[model samples]
Target: MNPVLPHNTLDQLFLSARTHFKWLPKPVTDEQLHQIYDLARMAPTSANCSPMRLVFVKTAEGKAKLKPALDEMNVEKTLSAPVTAIVAIDTEFYEQLPKLFPHADARSWYVGNQPLIDSAGFRNGTLQGAYVIMAARALGLDCGPMSGFNNAKLDEIFFKGTAYKSNFLINLGYGDATALFPRGPRLDFDEACKIV
Candidate 1:
């Protein structure tokens, strides 16, 4: 059996972690991004569908292309961050299920089913996005995740002629703690959950 994580590790991953809005000038390296994805990909997904695709908008040109899609509030923090990851879902992800889940004819399961494709793709893809955040935090980077961008515009700009669709964005780097507001409260376990 696996042991529970230590307190500091729990604190780093959840308890003390904050959604940052401002970033320092420090750069998040390509190696670091690769490491984050590597860590995230190991987490579970339904039938291992693994539909989440990422576009790390680190270059000025990429960010420029992404800028017009941003909501008014997300522009500055996004542009200033060292990297903004476009977390997206591949609508045709089941095409790879034969390779990813070879024990069964998984690809055939979604070949003609649009509803299954949409629901599983989006749900599992969103879960993978959350794993990305945890992996980033585990690697000592701060994250600012948001969904305020124009999805259609972002898709046109970044995913044209592709089956991928934008889901959300996560700005990444060392954060400026001085710019943070007080942490918000969470609902108690009784209020948010139940023992079945």
Candidate 2:
């Protein structure tokens, strides 16, 4: 078997994660996006309930639908991105927990607990979304994960008929660093970490 990326590889991912507004003329094919999810779904989820949903907006109409939902600054990059994934949470994620956690009663735990469901949905699904960003970078794709979009507008435009609702939007593609801002500051290990 081929070797996996080393510890430094993770640091590379951290280093590489940044806002990239400028894009190259490349297409992220449907199969490629599918492969990305197939690889990412392997990431762990709470009670095996995969609440995170992805909507790859590739067509012009889809991008147009997304524009009014974005804040003024995010409008252009999102439209230019090869693909924009509408990351969302499935409120009825328990329905799938049966299949995902066949050996356990994870589904019942969430059946009527809306608060617990909401917490689990947002927290766990956000983790899953983070996993997708890393998985995409591992696959040699650059990501511009942003949160300037209007969630209400997005939910109406993209999730109106579905139980799923928008969490955030991610612009995916090959990026041009020539247009990137200079690397910003970061917290040192001592400043951000604590061990008991």
Candidate 3:
């Protein structure tokens, strides 16, 4: 008999995942942050064209720099968190398609179409970003992901002349339940998904 079988399950974890976000009791160490990236990078990406980039802001300077990028309502929260990661997408992800999906001429599919490149780059990068969130949870870190900031402003401040662009920002640390609000509702699967 084969030892491998389809016996994995995610229901228990999914069912319990309520964005409750009662943060941790201690700090999120630098070593642990490195482990999160080590796991997040393993997830699949389009043609291996990993478009995502992470700017981990933990030092006082880095965190302070991110403060101006947030809305007035979020600045204090972000500043309080132990760390914030700038999740970004590489506009030139296609340049790595050959290395990621060498089985076919995947590079040609995006080489000429600017729109197509943007679409795939953003899509896959976003996917990876989501993966990072889940992995953070799996690794015992609380996450507060937000996309309310200005993308152009982020590009101007963080990306500068680089090909990478910020997709969203995520605050990672031990939650301070003292400030946590009630859990938000979510649509049921039937309402959100269709079998057809």
Candidate 4:
């Protein structure tokens, strides 16, 4: 069995993690980005169908391509962040299940099933996006995840002629704490969950 994580680790991963909007001028290095994905990829997914694909937008050119897709309120924060990751899902991800889940005929399960493909791709892909955020936080980076963008336009610009589809965006960098708004309250367990 696995040992429970200590307090500081728990705090770093969840208790003190906050959604950041403003970022420091410092950049998130390519090496760190790779490390974040390396960690996140280890997380579980159904049938090991890891469909998440990321496009790290760090260069001026990439950011320009992403600009028009952003909502007005998201424009400034997204542009200022050192890196913005486009978390996406591959509609044809099952093509790789032969290698990713090779022990059995997992690929056959999704080959001709449109509903299954859509459900599994989006569900597992979204889980991987959450893992990306947690992995970034564990690596001492801050994250600002947003969905205030035109998905169709973003897909046309960034994912044309590909099976990949954007699910959301996350601005990544060292955060500027001074720019954070007051933290909000969370629902109590009684309000948010049921203890079977």
Best by TM-score: 1
Per-residue accuracy of model 3 over 1-196 as CA lDDT, tens digit each: 7564333324322544434234554688888888889889899987788899999888889877777778887777677778888999989888887887889988898888999889888999999988888788778777888887778887888889999999998888866656666667889999999997
Per-model TM against the reference:
0.99, 0.93, 0.86, 0.98
Question: Model-by-model lDDT, in order?
Answer: 0.97, 0.88, 0.80, 0.96
TM-score of candidate 3 to 2 decimals = 0.86
Q: Indicate the worst ten consecutive residues by lDDT in candidate 4.
A: 12-21
Pairs with steric clashes in candidate 4: none
Best by lDDT: 1
- lDDT for residue 110 in candidate 3, whole number 0-100: 87
Which segments of candidate 1 are over 4 A away from where they belong?
none
Residue 91, candidate 3: Cα error in Å is 0.2
lDDT of 1 by residue, 64-133 (tens): 9999999999999999999999999999999889889999999998999999999999999999999999
